[model samples]
Target: MMMKNVSLLLFLIFATSLSFAQTDTLKVKTDTGNVKKDRKKVEFGPGKTHYAYAYFNFMFATPPEEGTDADIFYGKSHSISYGVRYRLKLAKFFAVGAGVNYTYYAWHFKQNDNKKIPTSIIYDKEKLKINALEADVFFRFNFGKNKKSPVGNYIDIGGYGDRNFSTKRQFTNYINDGNTTGYSDYTGINTGLNYMNDINYGAEFRAGYGSMLLFAKYRLSDMFTPEFKNEISSTELPRLMIGFEIGFHK
Candidate 1:
């Protein structure tokens, strides 16, 4: 009876030790696997990622080679645009992006022999302003070595479509009768021009380093409606624009 009791006690001790050893080994493996997964989650690269950014551009319109009806003062004719974009990096060197932009164009006209050009009334300072909302898509090509972040040199080739929401004509002139040496100024503003086109499309090109870029655009559509082309001057506004852009990102 004493020998059988001793043998039973030894058997229980052996089973308990075996169970504890197996539990400890499993715990160690699980902890090691969790550490490896955490390290992988924190690693960053410039592929298969998406980000959003905002940009602002200052643009200048190039002179047209057409008739005098579209002649404008080079320094005063300018455009300002701002937009936000989202980009998807498909590979280490390629990306696709889309954006929405708002652009304001001001064309200052010079005095011409024909007073009916752009507007019926002629003034010392005449400006034709247009407000537009634009949607654009582009493909980007990155250069140089890849880094942890997406800041690098890149070039973009794209196209854009615009909706002209507002069109206006503004004029200002100095008025002075034989009265005093001080002269009074006269200003007038007209809105909703029927001659203007409501839709416009263009091709865009951009080159940049980090957050700064230079851009050029060429309009592929006409600037005036069919009625204006038939009755009024058939001349079109400047189609080329050159600008510089600054981007914001994290």
Candidate 2:
């Protein structure tokens, strides 16, 4: 009986020790000082929960829409657009962001009509307008070991969709024969031809000064709309945008 009691007590002690020695799978709550010293591992917050930033940027445009045979006489030029981006980081270096952009330009056409000339056709534009809306989703890769500034120098690459919300095509005609009569036609080009989806890639440099922050990125992508091809010219595969990006996040 004594031996059996001793055996039972030993078994209980063994079981308790094993339970205490088991490795914990749950993350133990930690303060700043309790954080691991490794800098390679990405850390979201010492105790905080979220990260966000606001950015303002400008993009240079390139032609992605090519003109048909009727569009040869139509001339188009490069334009610039500006917008604001709101970013939310869901993980260490992954973020989802959105932006709104607007751009417009007018094209001028010139042609001569003469009875002496073999071709009596002319093409000209009185006014044209192009407007767009863009949204982006990107993943940011961070560099350096600064917690407050987790993003020292990083690359922001993602994909975006651009939609043309409004487009206007206008033309003016003058009658050279018979009675003195002239007319102008204003067409609302509501064709669904104002949408673009492309992959975006860019790099950013970040720095902080006192209370002000400085940041910049060089972004480039390909934007094309076939329905509005007559309104634009096709020259290249990708459009280039080089401008300063300024933003702050906490």
Candidate 3:
């Protein structure tokens, strides 16, 4: 009877150990399955993440076909714009974004004897510029087989509104006397100008490939107010802008 009782106790111990081993193996499998499910839920792709980017543009103006009052030096007149944009992907091929930028536009006038000069001021070198804050919203459409990144070919259509905070005119001229020759520089800045429009609106389009783009903008509103339209040669500045853009993304 003692031998039988010892054998029974040994059998009970072996059974308990086998049961615990099976329970541990099942727990491990269950945990691994959960991990895989979590990974599937968090996969990175288009329409799955928010994208942030920085962009810069080099711009040129297009004067009117008939005639323009502002005859600028094409090589010296340009625009500088830098801004941050926030994009929300709505679908695999579609997204929308908005941005705010600080933009500066400079137009250097030509002082040649043959060219018609602006009647507002006379100088050897003159520059008209404006400092503005711009806000824009756009829709983006992506193309190609890659959907895992936003750094692919795309097109954007947008509209922008600008608030011109500062308008400035800078003049430089060479002065000569019998004994000496010197340069004279004068700069005038005004936050509120009677001839300039404080608010402006425009339409913009962009075609991009791998973080680089070509853009064009057309101003629907005049740069000068109607009341002061005739003050500067009865004409307006250029209404079209063509440019290239570079985008920075992670």
Candidate 4:
């Protein structure tokens, strides 16, 4: 009886030790840092991506209607853009960036009068210009790291707000009167910005190589909420822009 009792006690001790030694495979937690750090801290100096840049943009507007081409955003997108921004890299794959940007967009159009010159045609080629000052804020995602470049290859999503403070339309009529010989130029007329809305807010997306990107934007506000009468309807539509920009950016 004494030997059996001793044997039973030994067995219980062995079983308890084995239970404590066994590890649970399902529960695991890793400590990422030796100390706590603020994720919002700003970084600067060498190898940083804070920069001022200039890029030529080929930007175009989306047509308002599917079948009709007469839209506020019609024609070619010849634009000039410049900005300064600071990039805060929080991790290998994520960053937050904000900047101020200035952009100028110009478009060319022609209105023809068939009745003005039946034998030959007369048309007014008008140039429209809009100047905007904007602020851009975005989050950037880097797919991987590249030590060769200051700015990584990234995808950016952001919001932008701009004041289209100035607008003008200038046109010169060209008369191709085969009756009168060649062509004649008329005095140019300049129109004001009163027809356009003063403010615009939009969403933007960009993807590209380091320092160069393809970009697009959709404006949430209407281009014109008429303050005047026109030949057509008083309401103007919201707009979209698509462009490419090359940046000396971080």
TM-score of each: 0.80, 0.40, 0.74, 0.66
Residue 110 of candidate 4: its Cα lDDT? Answer: 34
In model 3, residue pairs whose N, Cα or C atoms come closer than 3 Å (at least 3 residues apart or on different chains), thus clashing, are: none
Model 3 lDDT on a 0 to 1 scale: 0.78
Candidate 1: segments with Cα more than 4 A from true spot: 1-48, 146-149, 177-181
**On a 0 to 1 TM-score scale, where does candidate 3 land against the true structure?**
0.74
**What's the lDDT for residue 106 in model 4?**
77
Give the Cα lDDT of each candidate.
Answer: 0.85, 0.43, 0.78, 0.64
Task: List the candidate 3 regions with Cα displacement exceeding 4 Å.
Answer: 1-47, 65-68, 112-118, 146-150, 178-191
Instruction: List model 3 lDDT by residue over 58-167, tens digit each.
Output: 89987652255457777578889999888788887898989999999997887654333334556777877888999999999888853544567789999999999998
lDDT of 3 at 197: 83
lDDT for model 2: 0.43
lDDT per residue as tens, model 2, 11-48? 99999887766633222433333566433243443212
Residue 9, candidate 1: Cα error in Å is: 13
How many residue pairs clash in each candidate at the backbone level?
0, 0, 0, 1
Question: Which of candidates 3 and 4 is the stronger one according to lDDT?
Answer: 3
lDDT of 1: 0.85
In terms of lDDT, the best-performing candidate is: 1
